[model samples]
Target: MRTRVWDKMIHLPVKYFDEVKTGEMSSRLANDTTQVKNLIANSIPQAFTSILLLVGSIVFML
Candidate 1:
C-alpha cells in the first residue's frame, strides 16, 4: 500500500510538490499507513467475532 501511494505521488504534477513540503508528505504517508494497519489488525477480528456471536445468539434463541 505504501508502495502504491508512493507510485501515485510520483506521477503527480510538480506543482503539487512545489506547494506541499516533502517532510509533510512523508509524515502523512507514514501516519495513513499506520492507521490502515491498525484498523485491519484490530477492527476486523472484532467485527468478525461480533457477527459470529450475533449469529450464534439468534440460532440458539430460535
Candidate 2:
C-alpha cells in the first residue's frame, strides 16, 4: 500500500507541473523525499518497537 502510493508520487508527471515551471521541482523532490525518509527511517521503527514493548508488558502483567 505504502509502496504503491510512493511509486505513484515518484512517477508523477513533472513535465507540466506548476512547480516545475516555477523551478521549484528540485526543492519539492528533495524536501518531499526527506520527509518520507524521516517517517520510514525513524517513525516506523519507533512505532514497531513501542507496539512490541506494549504487548510484551501486557502479556507479562497477565
Candidate 3:
C-alpha cells in the first residue's frame, strides 16, 4: 500500500537521500503500489483459476 511505502520513505537513511531525488521516489512509490494492486487483484486470482480450468478441462476430456 502507499501508506506502507510512505512509512518506509520516511524511515530512509540520510545517505540514501544523497543519491535519490524526491521526484524519483514519488514515481517509484506510485509504481510500486500499482504493481502490488495488480498482483493482488488480477494476477494471482487469474493464475489460480486458469490452472484449475485447465486441469478440469483435461480431467473431463479423459
Predicted structure with the largest TM-score when compared to the true one: 3
lDDT of 2 by residue, 1-62 (tens): 34555566677777546445444655555676788889999999999999999999999999
**Candidate 1 vs candidate 2, TM-score winner:** 1
Q: Estimate the overall C-alpha local distance difference test score of candidate 3.
A: 0.92
The window of 10 residues in a row where model 3 has the poorest summed lDDT is: 23-32
State which candidate, 2 or 3, has the greater TM-score. Answer: 3
What stretches of model 2 exceed 4 Å from their correct place?
1-15, 18-23
- Which wins on lDDT, candidate 1 or candidate 2? 1
Clashes in model 1: which pairs?
none
Q: What ordering of candidates by TM-score runs from best to worst?
A: 3, 1, 2
- The CA lDDT at 55 in model 2 is 100
TM agreement with the true structure for every prediction:
0.81, 0.63, 0.84
- What tens-digit string does per-residue lDDT give for candidate 3 at 13-35? 99898899888988889987899
Q: Give the range where candidate 2 is weakest over 10 consecutive residues by summed lDDT.
A: 18-27
